[model samples]
Target: MSFPDFAKVIAALPSDDAEWGPRNTAPEGVPAILNNAPYAPYSKGDKLGRMADWTTDSSKDGRDGQRGGRQAYNRNFRDQQVYGAGASSLFSLQHAEDEATFSVVDNQRTSTKTRGGFGRGGGTVFRGGRGGRGGQVTARGGRGGAQGGRGGRGGRDDRYGGGRGGRGGRRFGWRDFDKPQRLRDASVNIKPDWKLLEEIDFSRLSKLNLETDEGEDVESYGSLYYYDKQYDKITPKGPEKRLQISERAYYNPTTSEDPVIQQLAERDEATIFATDQILSMLMCAPRSVNPWDILILRQGNKVFLDKREGAGFEFVSVNENAIDPPMDPTDGNKESINAPQALSLEATFINLNFAHQVVSESEERKFSFENENPFYNPSEETEPLASKGYKYRRFDLSVSEEEPVHIIVRTEVDAVIKSPVGKGDQFMTIKALNEFDDKAQGAGGAPNWRDKLVSQKGAVIATEMKNNSCKLARWATQAILAKADLMKIGFVSRANPKDAGKHVILGVSGYKPREFANQMNLNLANGWGIVRTIVDMCRNMSDGKYVLVKDPNKTVLRLYEVPFNTFDEDLEAREPVAEEDEE
Candidate 1:
């Protein structure tokens, strides 16, 4: 609480106005609430999970009996003492002094009874606490775990219900915090009973699986699963892998949200995360170019990122600015603090050496999940919003090729960095190549092209090229080669053609190819096509700083501004989104 809040609290007390909402309305600012609190022992009933949210003065009972009595929030320094069913209040007008000890009287029934469990079928085992309506009410967190136990004398045959008249707690609206329901797909409560799932034989579900089994008699296990789909009896190999990661994914560089550049305008923290919301960056430290060397490499006009292979990239925590390598000579160990001038690992190339999600002869993705493939177009002019990726990662791999996915790029798991020279570049760390070295016998054309006598070590480049079949990877690779054609990538903010503005992006992700291409007279497709050209240009620009701006005139997200970084003004590229047609 600040000084201003304290002053406000003082001024809003009783002296403020004698009659305000029957002297019980909560103070205007914040409320003091007590949630999930146990009721007084042997009280009328057990009520928890929201204590002191209400206060009653035995006040007037309005229409509908107002639950019978007028209940008000007692924020004006008032306290009430409640006793069990057998005990009386004994009555007192003065407020209690002990702030540590606070209690409330509940009108709910605080009793317990036995119950029986049911089998898989609809038939019931027995009735009581665990059975039907008269069954036991499950108790949870509270004094002595308030789910069971008895009240009053000698355990009577009584069934308690949820709160009702005289069943609520005393004094409310005071809480350390409130537990709001989460909006994500997973439940905060209710773990999926996989064990029970295993016990059930999918083959035995023939009757249930039969198409004719539709009707009221059909077996339905509430939240056990979703709409009728062939269950994968084999069980998912890695169900946990699909669990949603809370961190934000990298955004296309054309968007301003990439954590790497967003903060460029504000803080100077060298080891900053590309995600503004996350404090930690997945560190691939120790002489990996600058702090963020993970490039979104491209060749020609193609991108070369293999999601599965990217997983091989290491993710650690390190200070980008404080890297210090060992000064000792003849240190053969390469994983040093500061990489040797010759030792380098670039994110410029794509890695693709990971196991793919295996599919059975019949198993395959079939759902038309939204833009799951950025390239696949809609069947009709419009598409169903059902499986769209815009929502969450719920793509049914069986029904759609899209799986709940996240890529972790590890040098071992993904692709490796390609040095200036194709194959011999790996050995170039110790020696530089001369301009005219025709006599020098190097990686002889083929990558790692070794004479088979050396155990075919030369197959590394061939193997990489073989596995690098993804079109995006190819495009990115091409884009890397096309660097000389571009002076700088012009992130088009507006496309009026008259005063179109663009954020000139300096190089990122290690793409230092030839000169920049001028867009002045180069006519392109749509404004978005222009942006797409640039998004692929910047490697890992992952932050949702820019969103598709709907023109309202059309459904296309084609109008968005390139956010400016005043501090990085000097880093702007020399080229602009030129109005000239392709010369």
Candidate 2:
């Protein structure tokens, strides 16, 4: 064909077009979207490598499996003894006995439990790794091994190398191979590559004058965190970013006053008002875990005194330390009221827990105690506060801001160490059993015994802590002062509860102090010897609430009438403590 004729014929053949173009594609066409992935060069057709290895259904053998896959292949390996001759690799017909493991739980060792699988617990090494089941798997088959024997591996046992549960062995598996600490918690000892900064010596890097301006000790004008104000820039933290740790100290030094003089000053700068009247004084005060130190500066005249009797009697506790320092006489600034000779009392709350471990295995040590906690108890039920795991119990020892009082608590722990057997630790009331020891040292040949066990022993006592009995002692001062006649405030404990009834108040003491001196624990010199009369009326109150109020000095009643009960209000059991305001 000539060139011109061939071109003309090609043009004429294109006129019968059926809308075929490169833009659109037919449905379900794989190459519709051009894939940029690389492709191997084309080759010849397929062919068998080795006669198709006709035994295609051959089960997975250790040779064909990935790393650590030999365990499964070997686990089912037949027992050679079953065969009469040399049939070594034959599968065994005996049951897979060690398929699951048993976990120890409870201090009493009363229950039985078994777990299986390594899908979760770091290959049976970490306590949390076994069974993939956390606190929710509480089957009662852990203590008594789920089999015929006392500790035999049976029901729910983790066989095939899951070391936790009952008798679980460490099996080779592709899932756990090459993974460091397959079932254990390893320390995150990260060493960062400092690069050029490696030459920096961090131990003695530099000195920084970090100026802190947070809180000051009320009694001592020193800073909790020291800071130097001589720095270049100063930034006051906004109210939103600031945090208040505790109640503002009872005393504060003015900005103009010298810190040294504030320390030397013997009296407080502020005067608490309206406490002169016995009822008002007691109600308006902040509650304290420490019993208030009450003292009478001068005895009121028995004849000339206002004839108010019973709850209406006018009374006041003089706190000489609450007196403010005398004002400088030069500025013509005369003081409004002279400092009262007496003031409300102060006290120190005591904690029984000491530096040494006094309690071990739910009982006090054979020897003596380190620190004396008068409120210590041998039982397991903690009183005055309620708790659950993850969060500790906090109660408002104070009634409210309106009636500010001392802040107190029952215990300090996130979870309760519920004693499994009998009366548990008296301080731990919550029922949370997360105690375990997958790494228990003494458990010889036992598969991760500690990790899967739940213990009843309380928190390891290594610090000083006040016992729950301290609750009764908290209100000793107030109870003796305001509630003396009506509330029958005394150290009378009706020790009959289990065999008798439920209204047993406190099991601490039967020695109630009605006189002002013993109520505030004042020295003998500060008390009135003429009113030297304290009848041990509550001595026989061992089994009843009817406390006898014997007349001190055998003095007859001025107005003869039986004292009847009136008020039944409770100011305790307030809500949680509110964070103090930044202002």
Candidate 3:
């Protein structure tokens, strides 16, 4: 018997158990790494054919030991033959010239069974069976054959068929896991420092002065002599015109209280002097020397006083034999500077009546004083020699005055500098006198020269000791606290904490469905996983979660937790209601 035909044997073999085998031991076709091959012009189709040959060789080699020689040969031959024939047939079907004839014949056949002149099975596949005796061919039947199977019915031009169903979509779920809790968002602290305050200069102040002079009108006396020297001399010249002297001080009132003054009094640094009381003492005190001066100090600077004694005092005498002097004499001996001898007279107390007259009659009068003997209780009983017609009285000298002074006082205390950051020079100045006028017509129009002197002295002492011991403690404390606060807030390099959200997960091979589910559950437990995984992934990657679901046409990813109450309502409406069973 002849060996079974190879094509028939291969076709009859079960496809499930068949295997191609044993490729050539030597390299089958072209070596994967080609060497020294001639360059040949190639068409797109030729390149494709070469690629197919290479794939076939590779596949054969890969299955070498697993299949028999006959099986391999059959498989290769059948694949080439069947695939090639099928491809040619499909191409012919698409481009067949007989299409018009088929279409004409198909259209010509019609049935009156349907309103459209076509039966419901018009597009259905038909099968033919073997003819009966006489070898006549069988006619095509409408019913499908057992093995031929039914062909899909052609669809109406306008009607689209339902698409395949999609996979069940993924949803967010929660699972329990331990996690750390977060506390405060942030905290910071600040401390105080005095560097800026120290930089201010406090000693400088504007100085003001007023002065006046009195001289005899020699020309007028000469004119009186020309009219009648004897008569002018004899006639009591309108009570020798006296030179009236007065002094006043003025200042603006403000609400700012000197902190230094307050501290000084609190610490018992000095005594307070009331305005009225100081005025009374200054007015009553007798002037033993020419140009007696007084000074007031605020903090460490000098302040001008309201009034003081003048450069000299004069007494007028009436002389009947005195000859009047000539006006504008131009003689070398005419100019004379004969120093008057100091007078030593009996004790002369202030004329109370005269003082009262001065206060009541003067329009620009300032402080007034009663002429009671200011030195009534002198330290010694024996009176000293009189000088310049005034008794010498010993005055009590004490820095602290019992009464509060109208003048403001300040002290050197530690002040916290607010703006600049580093150590620097700082200063402050205090106003000494409340007021000084240039046109003042009084005993000593100038501010009390002694006040300026006292200020200079005090300022010198205070500036020498720049350190304010009292402020040091508080300043140090504040600075330390501020540094600590800065450290706590990570202002310092070493104190800062590691930056958050820097860690990332890695090493995953493929998308694991179960692992994704677990991660979703974990996220839910942590209040971050309520969103659907596919939807979340899509949101992270592109736009919609529908794109990620297996079937975009059917599956949907919804924001279930959004308007959670609405979701609950929908769930409640869809749920089945319970009914009582009949007994």
Candidate 4:
């Protein structure tokens, strides 16, 4: 209990030599089982720490401090020796395989380096051979150090040590060179039995030009109604003015199906016959992105241009040349109802309804052509006929008077407006551009029509010219063929941004056909030249059916001689089924 008792207790304890005596020695009566294994001793200098110290790594040492790499050692106990440091090698496993060959993937990018002035001290060397130490630099260039080479006073060296102002051995614009090319599918399948006749690219077709005079009218059919000026007075903002759904009878018979074209072919009137739609596509082939095909049927000597039932050419493509065009349902994109295919069908539907709804479809105000509607039958058809006028025009494609080569085309006019002189009417062609979703991908940077149509109609039309270049070009070409005085473009958008079922008209803009052609850089002579070239190719062939298809992947057109029954199955499938009258 006192100091004297504590001193006696400490003096009675064992000395240091005895406490540090052989640990391999067995206790008083126990057998020495571990005597041959040798004692693994610890140092007295080692400090007592936690049972399991996890914060131990070479990189954690103060001198080797590296962030985010390893656990840091405690500075207080850093100098103390570890208890098992000497015996660690005895417990470690040694295998014959080398572990250094293993690879590890790291995604961290290096920090950007600051640009330094030339002839100054070189930057830090991270990886590479070192340059000549304190030697005069050669005129060619100085060799790069570990990180990359440095520019000298004599010449500018590249990062890869390229000679004198050279781009390091690295390639420039590699992104474009390495980008994958898109492979698109053809609009029509080429059967194995088909024969290849020729392949014509846009580059070669654009070089050919032929100046031809304005075509002369052969005959006219169908009737057109006066345009109702009240429709143009609608406000070009908001959903207050919505498009009306007007059901009317409209016909789209192919060139061969036209009774007049067949009669002309029988009479040997000309060497070639085509519709305005087909002719315009051929003429403006160089500007097209979507693929199309025209069926060429050559009988004895005359050639007829026709299209398959439900062909892609029936609909106009929106933003066909956009950097990121609309994707199809199968392309893995969220297939909104407003996909390219759907938008095209919607555009076609809009044009048909817009033309019919804007016209005063009255029996008394209608103007009849030279002949009655060729495809319309009042007795069989129930719906009122739409306002459309068909004019058959003949163009001379002869190089000389001795060899006269003529082609006839069927063009259509949508509506008629009173002339400025108040004597006659001025024919017009009506077309519409529909917007699905401006915020959606592949919109081609189109502005909201409802917001900009009233204030900036010219800007809106210019955007359409850029995104729908091929479609607008075809429309202009058709108007030119019909010799129309004005071309009208209607801006239409969805009534609801997310809904594709309903749409409303935003505004209407009109331009003279010739002036619009000039603004769009549409060359009629170039188009005629393309038509003549194709006609010449088919003129010498034997009597059969030929298909001229635009290559989907490249800017080229290929002519193939297909069997006469190539598209017969589709036609048979499309036959209308009679419906029972509802109560």
Please, what are the lDDT tens digits per residue for candidate 2 over residues 234-283? Answer: 11221111111222221111111223222222232211111212211222
Q: For candidate 3, lDDT tens digit of each residue in 1-583?
A: 1244434433443455343321223132334332342222323232131122211221223322233322233644543422122122222223334333453335442322222111132221122211111112212332211111221221111011111111111111111123122121111111122111111111110011111111111110000000111211211112232212222111211112223234434554333311211222222121111112122222222121212112011111111011111111122212121111111010001111111112222224221122212223246434421100111111112213573212221111111111235543211110011111111111011212223223343332122112111111122222221111110000000011121111111100111222322422211111111111111222233221111011111111111111112223544654554223321
Q: lDDT values of the candidates? A: 0.21, 0.21, 0.19, 0.74
- Per-candidate total of colliding backbone pairs: 86, 60, 22, 2
The numbered model that scores best in lDDT is 4
Model 1 backbone overlap count: 86
User: Candidate 4, residues 440-510: lDDT per residue as tens digits?
Assistant: 65676566677767876777788778888898899999999999999888878898878877888877778
By TM-score, the best candidate is 4
What is the lDDT, from 0 to 100, of the residue 494 in candidate 2?
A: 13
Q: Order the candidates by lDDT, highest first — what do you get?
A: 4, 1, 2, 3
RMSD of each: 29.7, 30.1, 49.9, 20.5
Q: State which candidate, 2 or 3, has the greater lDDT.
A: 2
* Candidate 4 TM-score to native: 0.69
- Compute the lDDT for candidate 3: 0.19
Q: How well is each residue in 100-124 modelled by candidate 1, as lDDT tens digits?
A: 3667879775543433211111112
